[model samples]
Target: MHKEQEKVTDKNRFKSCMMKPDEEGNIYCPQGHAFTLEQRKESVKGRYPRTIQFYRNEHCEGCPLRSQCTRSKHGRTLQRTDKLAEMQIEIRENLMTETGQELMKQRSI
Candidate 1:
């Protein structure tokens, strides 16, 4: 993968592990604070174009995990996109199928 792609994936992995969005598109912090969708914009970060969704929370100011959670004075922030999310779901489903298992085995070679 490209360096930029790797960076994005790592950043996304970190955020997704820290905060996950539900089916209703609501993301919550580790302390159970809900993040609201701030904006949706089309962005071109790499060779591919994608739509970015920005989510933010306002309750991190006094939270004990603030320092550990985010460096932004504006509280915790997260970004995601529908395409990546859907791809993740599809990949998860693919990994369960026999063809995916075979593909994985081949990839280990």
Candidate 2:
């Protein structure tokens, strides 16, 4: 019982140490091997379907590190998490809006 408790504690600590905080106070760990935000956006934009599929199928298939990265059988596919993607979309939309353009100008100053 004591050993089991110790193992659990260690696991929690390890997880905590591996986490990185984003600007929005969310935690993520860009470790192991995965696509970057640019890559994910490109995939969504249909700019890199074949490349994405290759990673989703050939590279990630049957790898021992899958558990640490992705739960999908095709390997760890990177889709934008809701908040992250939404933020990007919002920013893009804002840039098109008059108010957003003003804000961008101010940011440049």
lDDT of 2 at 73: 61
- Measured by lDDT, the strongest candidate is 1
Q: Residues 58-96, candidate 1, lDDT per residue (tens digit)? A: 999899877767888898878888898788778878977
Candidate 2's displacement at residue 1, Å, is 52
> Worst 10-residue stretch by lDDT in candidate 2?
48-57
Evaluate all candidate structures by whole-model CA lDDT and list the values in order. Answer: 0.76, 0.45
Model 1 misplacement above 4 A: 1-14, 44-49
Model 2 lDDT tens row, 7-82: 4342353243333336763444333333323343323445433222112223556556446555666444333345
Clashes of 1: 0
Question: Candidate 1 — worst ten consecutive residues by lDDT sum?
Answer: 1-10
Clashing pairs in 1: none
